[model samples]
Target: MGSSARLRLYMNDNGPLILDGGLATELEAQGAKLQGDPLWSARLLHTNPQAIRDAHHRFLLSGADVITTATYQASITGFIDHLDVSCERARELLMSGVHLAKETAETFVCDARPAGQRCPLVAGSVGPYGAFLHNGSEYTGAYAQEMSIEEFKVWHRPQIDCLAAAGADLLAFETIPSIKEAEALIELLREFPNSQAWLSFSCKDGTCISDGSSFSEAVQMANRCTQLVAVGVNCCSPALVEPLLQSARSLLSPDMSWVVYPNSGEDWDSEQGWLTSEKTSASISELGHTWMKQGAALIGGCCRIGPAHIAELRRELKGSCTSPSSAV
Candidate 1:
């Protein structure tokens, strides 16, 4: 199906669609070591592809209606610099992420036959440039000052091209920190008129995006882009989702949907590991309802949230809040 048709089918549903949680965290849970790799989960595309597929399958069984690819931190430039692979090989790795997710979704559909489940779609994850830097700048939007629109487009186009050519259902421009990057991505989407995507930002607060731009401005910018199917926040604090959605709703067109996938409310120090936060103390499943109530049409988890969290969210959304499978 085309991207627009697939998105419309879900948007027209009675409730929000469930997206998969953190790909890297799930990979870690399965014993894939990703500590110092700049590519993060994307590196697994080269060393352990089956593990990537396994992660996707787990999310599918957990009732995720959409599964994002492991290409979030993968970039052609990063591959050339870090992995020292040829450009052709780098593109191959990017395409591999799409195929793995696609194959996993197809296999799950044929085997499970779950009730009320539409065929899950694959969203090619297009993470922020700061992600490529591995400096925690993705959470800060601090890279905007050094990056220009042309540079941003040049940096992002190849990844977008590879993902689109690989036949992903939609592009997920996720964890976007600045309005400049959002605009650059929207411009790049024009290079492929048939492509559709969702623009999700990393917010510093309930009302402001990571770069200190108002959510209203970001939503308004997205509203002008024809190829963007939805716009909202991701990789931010769960506590801020409600107000972010409210801000988006106030600025977005009625036809546009909103997506929310926040972290486990933990603060990540580059030196130390994840620190717990009282603000994120509520279970992700509990937060799902509130996000939906605030007009989020797609909901999922981000950092530190794993398959079990997704399973609980699925059960909660399906109105069957029983125990999820231990396999999760």
Candidate 2:
């Protein structure tokens, strides 16, 4: 079956899908210094790809049904400007990010998972345009003012082409902060007619996407996009998810599923990393059940969230989340 068909089949048998937690958080735990690096996790795609694979493996063992690639901050222009590579070399780096994640997922299933169950899917991580700016513009979407939808599409196409050609099962247009960008993505998906994807916005609160557009309208727009398998929030405060879904509940098409992976309730700094003062407010183990009730079939964490948190989510929902003897 195709990946989308397999998605339906898996959900029918597996209840809800458990997505992996933050890549940068896991990378840092494994000794990556990412602060001030424009590439963030994508840097590891070129310098330490084994680390990216290791992080994905940990999430799979922790009960993730889907693991996204390390290309979240990757873009052709960003790679060229920061990595000092030609456009062709930039494409190779983006492709490597997907290969690493795909390799990890395939190896994990072949070696450790059971024979009859569905193996985890690898999602190509496509962050918003602002992420390439290396600022907090991803949260505010202030950059949208500088680019038209056509321009936005132009900026994003190269990365999408590279990722889709690299063999990811799906694309994650994640942490988007504006409805304009989301609409641009909706149009862009039509160009890649056979690809499957999910669009997730970064919210300022429960009711509005970061650009202050009506999220209800965003959801309604996403409802019309056939290429999208899911739509919801990501990298926002966990407290905001309940109301965000609640607001969109009445309008959502039954065909469109929800996919959410909020942050660990920690604040961010463009100059510094996640602040140290925030207490552990993830409570993903407890809140994940609530989100599932809100139609979030795919759930996980973002910044400051790690493998242990994901394991707790699994143990809470699945009874046993990993193979005791499995090594990754």
Candidate 3:
């Protein structure tokens, strides 16, 4: 098979669909300072569009087949948290992130493709609601009259609608900690025409989300999507997701793919109050290949892992695969 065959397999099958994660936040951490930006805390708005595009380009070079738009923090939850901005403006920024990714891929990847391909398809990333539950969980229950589900519908509908309209190849909902949030997201995605969506859980351990729903239950619910193309895990430590895959494999249909985009084992400290960083390219690559073996057909990086890690993943994958077309 040729390049087209491999690309087609990546596009259609339950094999590794490598994605690059954490551009805006990672970029800021890498010292791309954006002072005075009201959205500085939001990362997506604080980071320069070119910088975000450049990060996507870097990921592609590192062998990422898919590059997600830096739209996670562009949402209402993110914007309000970072800048105290209105929901509408935040939604606009979210849509803008999608558009920027589209534009960037067209400019950078189209010319870089082997021959006939125009651009790398962009995955639109939707993050969970920023507000943590009183119990330190993220999945909230029935909305209050002030911020009811009905209100969220009005706030989030625009972002979901715009991402669909922007021709995002897939909807990648990341780090969802609640069953209610996942169901709501699936409902929202159903309203978008021609968009394929995937739901990912944020598990601190391999078994359950932060809110205590078992990973098995989460996968069962996510499989309910009428337009779901695939589902898996992201944002938690890599060590935790391997066994989770084993438990879910029996439930997942062969045609429906599984993804694993883990963080660098880093977390926010409680008493010290700082980011704990423990990601490495070698570790990420090793774990990525391990994830692939453990039933993660789609492998990639998340928080604290960047293009370098993605590149290493591609290198390792090329070395392991039998496909000649996988050669960079």
Sort all candidates by lDDT, best to worst. 1, 2, 3
State which candidate, 1 or 3, has the greater TM-score.
1
How well is each residue in 86-203 modelled by candidate 2, as lDDT tens digits? 9999999999988988888889878886434468988899999989988889999998988899998998999999999998888999999988888898899899987889899999
| Model 1 per-residue lDDT tens digits across residues 174-205 | 99999999899999999988889999999999
**Highest lDDT model number:** 1
Model 3: how far residue 48 lies from native, Å: 2.6
Name the lDDT value of residue 158 in candidate 3. 65
Please give the TM-score that candidate 1 achieves against the real structure: 0.95
| Stretches > 4 Å off in candidate 2 | 115-117, 276-282, 323-328
- lDDT for residue 89 in candidate 1, whole number 0-100: 98
Clashing pairs in 2: none
Task: Write the number of the candidate with greater lDDT, choosing between 1 and 3.
Answer: 1
By TM-score, the candidates rank as 2, 1, 3
- For model 2 the TM-score comes to 0.95
Reference-based TM-score of each model = 0.95, 0.95, 0.79
